[model samples]
Target: MANTKQAVPDTLPLLRDRIDSIDSQIQALINERAQCAQKVAEVKLAEQGGDAVVFYRPEREAQVLRRVMERNEGPLGNEEMAKIFRQIMSSCLALEKPMRIAFLGPEGTFTQQAALKHFGKSIVSAPMAAIDEVFREVESGAANYGVVPVENSTEGVVNHTLDSFRDSRLKICGEVEVRIHHHLLISPHSNADEVTHIYSHQQSLAQCRAWLDRYWPHAERVAVSSNAEAARLAAEAGKNGRAVAAIAGEVAGEMYGLMTVSANIEDRPDNTTRFLIVGNQEVPASGKDKTSLLISAKNEPGALYHLLEAFERHGVDMTRLETRPSLMSRWGYIFYIDFVGHYQEEGCQAAIAELRDRASEVKVLGSYPVAVL
Candidate 1:
């Protein structure tokens, strides 16, 4: 058996004192870091001479988070350690200048979750009604950056987001992946057994289709604008004596003051969604990076073959290839390609040079640091 001293760590009061000392040290160090960040802002402003000074550096933050994970030893996991540093960096950056972030929402949506994940909660979040509105918000300078869902692991790409990219000139500054956990939620006054109507976003409903099919097969599954909206509707319906439940994330449930009838009701175990960060500033190469391109290949038969060949010949890694119908011509289509390495790198540059020569048009969407967390 373990010794009582080893197991109990002596006394609670002594432990509390040690914790209090550590807390004081942590607070002092954090203030010192914030002061350094303030100096950085002053330096940048002095050099740039006005509002042209840029504050947030996604690559720098990613590097710091990666180092935090690498250097972490023990009681906490790597992600947990990184999360602590992420918030600290967020607070320090806020001391420099608080950023405004836009996302698809009425708040409490997965996109909002992603926005917070990528930029941290120190930002001022602007909830946009639609994907296009998110683009417009950032484009018009209403928000410094925007977050939108690009694809879900189970359901595939968000067509609306991809479609929005065709017209907008926003850059893909970074990426974040959010694990989706859906719950069957109801108001406190709701009778769980009496649920006759179910509400959720179409994607969320489809994600939890199998579970819903097996349990409440007869409940009318109504698709709404967003999961948060569904939660709001369920809250309203319960007060009116209607038996309604919504399939949404925990954030939505808390926001709408609803209780979870069933947690993690999704059919798949790993229902993850990837969101893209859209902004105006171009991110510099961050060692490990990915480049996105919008290519319009000629209608000729061998056009796509030539584009693919360029990447193969240069020994460049291609990660994603998505096709969208071109708005300019009826028969033509736009190809969205994502590949490893920054566009400025020699290999990527050679490959892209070859792509432009073979294709009718080529647009470099953005080359950004790969997601670190």
Candidate 2:
């Protein structure tokens, strides 16, 4: 018996066979699911009478994911299960209709991530270089919808998005809030201790200003088009082994082959950014809805107060009121407002009429379901 080795169980072949069987079953189930999705599309088309509306219902998909997570009882946690369901729903929705979503990008930005989270992995994404370009893409029918950041918990409203709405005819179809986690990334070849310059989008840099001041106080902060773009630039310059890095998402590190030297570098831990979905079509009433409008008030005395009074008398709840200087004319202002109630309701109609009467110009941007997040 002198040191003779025992035979191995050869479980690898058995496991391989089991995997192949499961893959076949999964393939069959996928085909069946796709057929069902086609039926859903047909039903939606019949109900809509060929009206151009996106077939994907994000709220419904979210409900489905919530149910799946609640029922899951496996080695995987609730978040893991929800993630899997999210992708599945994305695929099924794609079968119903593959949506083209335009987002502010060069990928890996929080905006891109939020768009993917809302639209699912099945959507075709176009990364627009500028925010205006994203609005243009949706307006021109080149994309089904556009996703752009409207506000952040830490830094307040994104003024550019508000200004764009002043001229955009696209309606707000939906909204989503994504938790923004900023990270400090450096190329693998770079020495963190020797870093002299940091780069990121201006807003992101601003969001992490306190942290940057506390840590790399002497480093130069260079702003780029986006956080992801800054990551790309840092990775490119790694060949020279310069002391350079960027602040971006952790995923960006993996995408650009960089390393996350620090995580959660934002000044606040509960930083969340709200993004709006813009399209040419209105979203169906989901019971509770919020409508956004752009009102241009005359510079006359009491013009603003009168507009606010109209909503008060109509029993409508106003969520936000922001003022922007009118670009076309001097001594004029544009008021962006968010209010409760659907545009189709009687109270909402009365409020809108009153608002128009008081304001020099009033534009109803869109009414869409309130995002629970």
Q: How does each model score on TM-score?
A: 0.95, 0.85
Alpha-carbon local distance difference test for all models: 0.91, 0.85
Candidate number of the best TM-score: 1
**What is the alpha-carbon lDDT for the whole of candidate 1?**
0.91
Clashing pairs in 2: none
Which digits, one per residue and each the tens of the lDDT, describe model 1 over residues 93-202? 98999999999998999999998888878989899999999999999989989999998988888989888877789999999999999999999878999998999999
Predicted model with the maximum lDDT:
1
Instruction: Give lDDT tens digits, candidate 2, residues 176-247.
Output: 889999999999889999999999999999999999999999999999999999999889878786868999
- The parts of candidate 1 lying over 4 Å away from their true place are 1-9
What is candidate 2's local distance difference test score? 0.85
Clashes of 2: 0
